[model samples]
Every structure is written in C-alpha cells, then in structure tokens.
Target: MVKFEYAPAPESTAVVDIAPSYGLFVDGAFVDPADGEPFKTVNPATEEVLCEVVAGGPADVDRAVQAARRAQDGVWSRLPGRERGKYLFRIARIMQERARELAVLETLDNGKPIRESRDVDVPLAAAHFFYHAGWADKLSYAGFGPDPKPYGVAGQVIPWNFPLLMLAWKVAPALACGNTVVLKPAETTPLTALLFAEICQQADLPPGVVNIVTGAGETGRALVEHDGVDKVAFTGSTEVGKAIARSVAGTRKRATLELGGKAANVVFEDAPIDQAVEGIVNGIFFNQGHVCCAGSRLLLQESVADEVLDSLKRRLGMLRVGDPLDKNTDVGAINSAAQLARIRELSDIGEAEGAQRWSPACELPDRGYWFPPTLFTGVSQAHRIAREEVFGPVLSVLTFRTPAEAVEKANNTPYGLSAGVWTEKGSRILWMADKLKAGVVWANTFNRFDPTSPFGGYKESGWGREGGRHGLEAYLHG
Candidate 1:
C-alpha cells in the first residue's frame, strides 16, 4: 500500500492579537490582580507561550463577587426584561461578527481542531446567547411560576475543554434570567474569556454585569465558596463537583455541576454499519475525546462485533492527527501536558489490565502534546479503561449478545451522563432509551448538541441542565 501526503493548510494566527499579559476583567474593565501572581498560558499545539494571565486569588474572587452583587442590586436588576434581552441580542450579534477570530483563538488556547472550534464551538456559543436572549422577556410564561426572580450573584467555573462555549452556557442563561455572574475560565484557556469581556464592553453592557476572573482550581474554589455568591455553577471533574456540593450543602447557594462521564455507545446488530462506524468515531474521537459526555465505550453486538471493529479501525486510520490550525486535521493536540500525562497513564493501565490496545499508524507533531486515536478490545466491565473516564482519544470496545445485555452493560457504571444507541429497529431504540440510566440518550446518533436542548448528566456526571428552558431554572429563584 502507498501513503499519500498533503501540504499543510494552516489557518492564520494573525487574526488574534494577544497582549503581553492579561489582567482580570471586572466591572467592565480589565484590572490587575491585587495579589499580583501571574501565570503564563501556552499554545498546546506548539508549546509556545501565548501570553501571561493573572492568577486570580481569593481577593480577586471577592472583588468579582462584590461587583456581581452590585450589578445585581443596582443597575442589572432594575433593567427591564426586554431591555435585558436586547443586551443579550447585541452580545449574540457581536459574537457572530467576531466568530472567526474567536474560533481561531479557541483552537489556539484549547488545542482542539480549528474545524471544530470554528464550526461547532463558536457557532454554538453565539447560539446559546441568541436562544436565551428570546427568553429574557418571556420568563413569566416559562412555567417557573409567576415572576421568577434572579439569583443574586452566580459563580461559574468552567473547564478547559470547551472554554468559550462553556462560558456561554453559564453566562448566557444567568444573564437572561437577570442574574449577575462572576466566571472563572480554566487557567490553560483564559484568552477567549478575556476577549469575551471585550465583547461585553463593545455591547455596552452594564458594568459588573459579567465579570471574568481567570485562574486554576484554587480560584474556582474561592469563587464557589464566596459568601456573596448566591449560585454556584461548575463544569469539571466529579471529585470537584462533589466538593462544591459539600461546600454549598447547607447554604442558600444554588449549585449546578456538569462533571465527568464514561459514556457507552451501543451499536446493535441491525444498525446501519457505516453510520454506526461513523458515530463510533465521532462519539469518541471528536475534540480528541476531551468532551465530558464523550462516548468512550463502544458496545457492539457480539454477532456484528468483528465487522464493526474492522470498519471502525479503518475509519480511525483515516483520521488526521497533526496541527490543530490545519483545517484538514481531525484529532488535534491534547489540551495540556498534565492532561496528556493522564491519558498516557490511563492508556497504559488499559494495556496492563489485559486488554488489546490498538491505534492506527499516525505521526504526531514533534513539539506538541499528541495522543493517537486508540481503542481497546477484549475489554471487560471490570477493566479500568471501561470504568474510568480517560477523557482522551481512547475508546474501549465491549461486546453484548442481546439488547438486555447491552442495556445492562451500558448502565453498569456509576456515571449516567450520556449514552448512544444505534439500531435500525425503532422499538429497540426506544426501549434502550428508556432503560439506559442517563440524562441524554442519542438514538442513531452521538455527541449532538444544540442551544435549545438541555445538555447535562445524571448520577455522578453532575446535576442540573445547562441549556434550553430547564437550564434557566438553575439561575432563577422561585
């Protein structure tokens, strides 16, 4: 067999202008951190330092919380619903205008393929604002009783995987519900959040309406534990989610967490083989499998297991693993060194635990953190890869003999975040959907997201929804 090589098709980085260092965005302005500790953010694709960002500490969190409270009590709370909606509309439009720049910046910071950031993340981020923008004036008819009030100040901590999109998920709804927010973007990916702060300024949004504090987990903890905050929204690890729950357990703080997952994508024997194979690849390999609700476990019916695995392997080989800026690249670099280490450790465990590990022949870039699209066969329910969330470009293949077995194996884990069912039989799809213990179940599809759909998890995957009408409940008062 002969291999074909293609020329590099890289997107321009000049679209994004990075400053030497960035400060915290508070009260409609960028301010230096009080404690003055700064951290450098890098491009995971090249390991080059992009810019220095302020490491927001407790004092910074307090200041942001106070600003949000002031906005909630003074200007933002008094703004009429329709007027509030107009602001969101303005934001959505501005996001659209800067979509390309934001997408490129997102790919730079998050190490995801430029294609995904441009096509999926940026568009969805804008859409989230647009979807909730319409709801601002229609809260009375939203089935949340008459005249639902906003939670005073929401503290939102988003993960690094989908930085800007997750920010949109938290900020758009909270603002639509008339709540003020203090958001902390993950330390590794703070540039886009700061750019969003500039967008807020361009929209002429009220000072303190949306404040962004950038830092690591400690900053998030401070924001979540801040007494001035009335609502706590987080998207990260399950351990951190549980900690947030405990911290706000007896308090009046309303918390919504979107955490980890070890999702199962079940392909029945009667399913379209080609479509199921594509779904399997998309479910696990998209975003380099960094997604929280990623279908990391592929469950194929025993009868069709060999055929599906062959098809899946062939498809995986075709995936481009290289520069994220290259439009043709399918799987990009891992988000960070720490994350790459974790993926390596987990993949090693999968091999050590007596599972057959396989990856297509692919050459990774020399400078960046890269992990090839990998899958394990002969995986049992007891295997570490099947049980734990590797959160990388890794998939575990398990076989089931019947529909009952598939359902049983799918729900066998502690996670109930998301699941996928692929079957030509509509009845089996519906039955599996009902039986699977997950918040979101996709029939004949996988990893599909929309601004108007409620996306979240059950069990240890976290609580509450982040999209649509149900998402508004998390930031509103009864």
Candidate 2:
C-alpha cells in the first residue's frame, strides 16, 4: 500500500492570547477571590499550562450568589424586557465577532478538534443567545401564561466538554427570562467562561446579571445549596445530578439537570450503509466522545451486523487522530488524563469479560492524553462497557435479532438522554422513535443539535430541557 501524508495545517495559537493568571468574575468585574486557593488550567492536548484560575470556595460562592441576588432584585429586574433583549443581542453580536478567538481558546482548553469548536460549539453558542434574545420581550406569548416571571437567581454549573456552549445554554435562557446567574465552569475548562465574562462586560450587561465562578465540586455545591439562588441548572455526570437532586430535596429551589448518556445507535438492514457508517463514526468520535448524548452503543440488526462492523472498522482506520489544532484531524485528544484513565479502565474490563476489543492503527501523540477510536464486539448487555458511560472515544457493538430486540436492548440501560435510529423504512423509524426511552432520537443521523430544538433526557439522564421555548420555563415561575 502506498502511504500518503498531508502537510501540517495547524491553527495558529497566536489567535488566542492567554493571560498568566485569571480571577473570579463577580458582579461584572474580574476580582481576586477572598481566601480562595488557585489552580492551573492546562491544555489537555499538550499537557501545557494554559493559565492559573481561582478555585472559589464557599465564601466566594456566597459573594457571587449575593451579587446575583442584588442584580435580580434591582437593576435587571427593573429593566424592560425589550432592553434586556437588546443586551443579549449585543452579547450575541460580540460573540459572533470574536467567534474565532473563542473557538481557538476553547480548543486549547477543551482538547476538542478546532474544527468542532469553530464550526459547532462557538456558532451554536452565539445562536443560542440570538435565539433567546428574541424571546425576552415575547415570553408573555410563549404559552407560559400572560405573566411568566423570572426565577430570582440561578446557580449554574457546566461541564468542560462544551464549555461556552453549555454556558450559553444555561445563561442565555436565564437572562432572557429576566433572571440573574452565577455560573461555574468546569475546573479543567474555565478559561473560555472567563472570556465569556469579558464578553458580558463588553456588552455592558448589568453588573451581577451574569457572574463567573471557577472551581471544583465544592464551589458548585455551595452555589447550588445557597438559599439565595432560586434556580439551579447543571450539566455533568448522573451521580452528581442525583446528588444535586437530593441536596435540593426540601428546598423551594427549582433545578434542571442535563446528565450522562449511554445512547444506542440502531442500524437496520435496509439503511444506507455508508451514511450509517459515517453517522456511527461521528457519534462516538466527535469531541472525542465526551458528548453527553454520544452514540456509544452500536445496535446492528443481526442480519447485517458483520457487514456493518467491517465497514465501521475500515472507516475508523482512516480517521486522523492527532493534534487537535490540525485542520485535517478528525479525532482529537481526550479531554483530560482522568477521563482517559476511566475510558481505559472500562475498556480493560470489556476485554477481560470476553468481549473483543478492536482499534485502528493510529499513532497517538506522546505528550498528551489520547485514545484511539475503539469498538468492542461480542459485547453483551451485561458487560460494564456496554452498561456504563465511558465518555470517551469508545463504542460497544451488539447484535439485535429484531426491531423489538433493538428497542429492548437500547432501553435496557439506565440512561435515556439520546439515541439514533437508521432505517429507510418510515414506519420502522416512527415505531422505534416512539418505543425508545431516550429524549432525542435521530433518524439516519446522530448528534445533531440545534438551538431551536428542546434537548434533554428522561429517567436518570436528568430533568428538564435546555433549548427552544421549553427551556425558558425552567428559569421562570408562573
């Protein structure tokens, strides 16, 4: 075989100017945390130190929540909905203008391919703001009754996988509904959130309308547990989601959680094989499979299981897995060492439990966290890899004897976040969509997200939707 190599086409790092250190963004300004520890945020792709970020504590969370409360009770609450919408419009425009810079910074901090950060994450974030901006003055007609009111203060905690986008998902809707927010970006990817704080400043948004607190679980716990906050929004692991649910058990506080998923991608025999293969590759490999709605379980009809597996393996071999900055790269570095270790642990268990582990021949960079696009065949529903959320570039392949069996296997897991159905038969697609327990089902596609669509999960996948008109309800009271 003749090998072909392409020239390096890496994105320029000069586009994003990272500061040596950053502070918490509270009350619309960047300030040093009071008696708080500082931690380093690194580039997962290179294990290089990106910047020092403050680790907010209970007191810091209190300060942020107080600021948000003050804003919600004063300036923001008094502002007209049209005026509030104008501010969001300005933020959205600023985000669009600085999209490239934010995209580069996100890729640096998040270790996702620059292609995704640029094309998907950043744009969708801006779109979210744009979409919600129009709803600010129109909430009365959103079918939430004539006088839907904003929840006073929202304590939002976002995951690192899609930092800015998740921030937009939580913050945009809250602000549009006239709520003030104290947002905590995930510890590993706090830089972009801080940058977004700067965007809020540029938009001249009211002081304390949006506050950014950078920290680990303790800071998040304090914020959510604070009595001052009227609403809580979180996107992360299901275990933590359950913890948040329990923490707010007796409180009057309302919470919305978008949690983990073990989505099943069902491919029927009548489907378009090539497109199905592409969707399968994209579902598990996109964002290094850090997505909450990743199609990690491959459920192929028994008659075509072998053919689909062969195509999937061959396609995986051609995937470019290296520097995330490379324009040609298809798969990028794993988000962090801890996530990579977890993926490895689950994969090892899969092998030990009589499943066949297979990965393409791809060279990983020596200095950074990396995992090849992997698949496990002969995997039963009982296997740990098949049951748990790996949150990495891993897929578990299972054969299904019929449509009923596929639905049964798909709904067997505890997660109900998302699923994919690939079939040319419209009736089968409709039937599968109705039967699957997941919140979002993609027919012949996978991982398609839109700001206009309501996205969330059922059962253990968490409560409430994060997009479209339905998202506003979480931040409002009738």
lDDT of 2 by residue, 1-478 (tens): 2335878899998988899999999998999998679999899989999889999988898999999999999999788889999999999999999999999999999999999999999999999999999999999998888998997999999999999999999999999999999999999999889999999999999899999989999989989899898999999999999999999999999999999999999999999999999999999999999999999999999899988988888888888889999988888888888999999999999999999999989888999999998999999999999999999999999988889999999999999999999999999999999999999999999989898999999999999998998988898888
Clash count list over all predictions: 0, 0
Where does candidate 2 stray beyond 4 Å?
Answer: 1-4
Tell me the TM-score of model 2.
0.99
- For candidate 1, lDDT tens digit of each residue in 282-329? 999999999999999999899999999988888888888999999999
lDDT of each: 0.93, 0.93
Worst 10 residues of 2 by lDDT: 1-10
Candidate 1: segments with Cα more than 4 A from true spot: 1-4
